[model samples]
Target: MIETMGDQLPAADIESFLPLRRCSILSYGVGHMLNDITSACWFTYLLLFLTDIGLTPRDASIVMLSGQVADGFMTVFAGELIDRFGRFKLWHAGGSVLVAISFSSVFGGCLLCQILGINSAALRTIGYSIFAAIFNVGWAATQVSHMAMVNCMTLNDTSRVALASCRNAFTMVANLTLYGIALAVFSINDAKTSVDIEDQYRWIAYVSILIGCCFVGIFLFGTKEPRLKQQHCENNQRVSWAYWFSKLLYYQVALVYMLTRLVTNVSQALLAFYVINDLEMAQSSKALIPALIYICSFAVSIILQEIKWNGWRLKAFYTTGAILWIFSGVGIFLLPSKIHNFMYLLSITTGVANALMTVTGISMESMLVGKDLNGCAFVYGSLSFLDKVSCGLALYLLESYQSSPSSEGCHDITSCQSVTRYGSGLIPAACALVGAVVTYTMNLHDTTPKSLSEPLLA
Candidate 1:
């Protein structure tokens, strides 16, 4: 290919073609900062906020499930539409607008109640649920479009991985920023009434939205839609969904991506409750511990950009992360409140595991998509459909049982600390283990006839 390029191109043409720049990398990296910030708020604080604001665990789970269900369906629709119509930036911008509004509504208290003068728990739950679903709809659009951009961004495998790593690094920044904001809010609030307490969350939501929107504007300005799409992106140029269904690699990537999401989302949702209720830690630990985790994740993500990636390295790093989570889970399950301080160490370990698994898992998806822009959005959207739904169901089941009268005779090995322990510990470990095993079996790069047996990976 290099020799062919040399033969075809004049010396002047070659030099004129410049490589991607540091500024370009920064622009691409922060493209999803809004999604990252809002998502961090969603997974880390949604349940805790709902329960604190007076909803039952079951009700809180319902709101969460509604959002997940809406998100799951929207991913397919959005992916199909983007593939057929091909306005990546239009979808991204429109979705960002929806997210900014609906996410604010989700945390700003029940719009219906505020208007109707009704404060009933059921009504508030329903109101929050509506906004949650709407927020997730927009979220699906943004996530699918941004992830699919990896293929169109560049052909170099290393460059592709760099984009993903930079994205992950921004995600860590977003999470940390959220925790810092939450810590400041929690630290300053001295509310005695339910109204004041609710206002604190409202303030947090508003501030987060403001910060996220500013970065989103930067992303919109700096990034350009792929020029190739304008010519090739026609509705008739379709790859049948069956094209993906027949590939074993499709299933492998889908499963690992789904399970990896489960590990991250479920554990994150439970982290606050685990620290506050299970360990009886300080109120600030809810924010502080997660901040610590993201700090470590941010550092690791920056480092991953420097490494040369490949199939074996991907699997090895992912497996190592999984093994670390296994150890973290065991530590969580066995450590007593007597040694709650040790939870900080476990948090650090979990952060490292998160960065490793998440970056590699997403890079694997990019590898699978490769140059196949025909249904690339469908690939990401379908996988995310699985991810959102599975995560929703898992959290709903766990939250529903967290405060059960019997809890089905479940023992905490010390004290019955509800389902927080299991959700934050056991479930993620098992999911990681399964994802790791599946990663081992994946044929990362295959060379064969493109018509009948084109391998997905590079």
Candidate 2:
């Protein structure tokens, strides 16, 4: 069992804590990259793929929303399972296989529809939705188990940050690869028309499966979880649902982090629409925008580790990120239609902001929960649940609003940019503002590294 403050281990015993393992970190980081590659493929392409195949905007939104809801519920259940069973490696490996298979099934279902000469949009949408839900269940299990294992691997704050930074670096690589494939598959022809991408999507499925198997194999074989010192304490404690809910609601840092995650998801869901439909950019720009964002974020993540904040409060980072994001959001609204380059500038701003917020949010949560593995898993699960549900509802509303007859003028692109502006710009800005305000109100002071003796709730 890993020793935590709750374990009340003597100062001399601190040296007995498991040392950070570089090989384990590398394995986990690579697994995270693979996991995200598959996830990014779904989030960045799946809805657009659905619409391209025949579903209306609202139909696509409904499919994604259903998947998000299912994923949310599964996340809660998976968190409990992780806490109860302490089988992180098993869950991680099993969930990775499930995610790869189910994710491939989504594309396979589309292929089947095309092969069968299925012309009915309603029938295709139903088929796709079922596959999407199955994919989300696997995704929920994979993500929850993967995140929970991080804290279990190491209790040292510095080591944790190193692991997180490594993971973020892989995230950058994954984004690059993901967008590269998207650009190749979805590139426009000489007539400025998009090529048929259904076949290309099938190829993506096969690649994802291969990559998932290899990376998950690395994680399963390379990493080892230390024995937790609080095993007896956990065995004696039976936490109720009500208690979990109360803790989730009362935890200010977790709430703030959840809000940030929600905004990030909402922004992501709007990105392809904003670039392709609103900005009227070329298909290549879709890949370019995200690529630039990740590049800038990757740079910022590396720099953050070396730079000192110079007395700035932890909340200051959140506030600063929110303000930067707000500026980018407003920039999106004000950018002229003909100027595509300015979009790159906005992407950079948003990327830096995201880097700051994401690193700070994860670090803050770690500090708040200390070395409590169960608390860490539960908090992450709650955040995932809230982030998915909120983003789903937001997307449903945005898509429904855009699809209404009253918004038909938006089809002209020139006549009505309001829907796009609001969806991509004003709404995200509002969310950032709200997040900033809540973070400020938390009034948490920066504390030096110290032992935490009390339970997370206590």
The TM-score leader among the candidates is: 1
Residues 130-203 of candidate 1: C-alpha lDDT, one tens digit per residue: 99999999999999988887766654556667788899999999999998999899889965666676787788
In candidate 1, residue 403 scores what lDDT? 75
Clashes of 1: 0
Best by lDDT: 1
What TM-score does prediction 1 earn?
Answer: 0.91
Alpha carbon lDDT at 54, candidate 1: 80
Model 2 residue runs over 4 Å out of place are: 1-22, 108-118, 188-195, 229-251, 305-313, 403-416, 443-458
lDDT of 2 by residue, 274-387 (tens): 787767777788778988888888888776654322114457877898999899988877676567678999999998887777767666655554455655567667777877
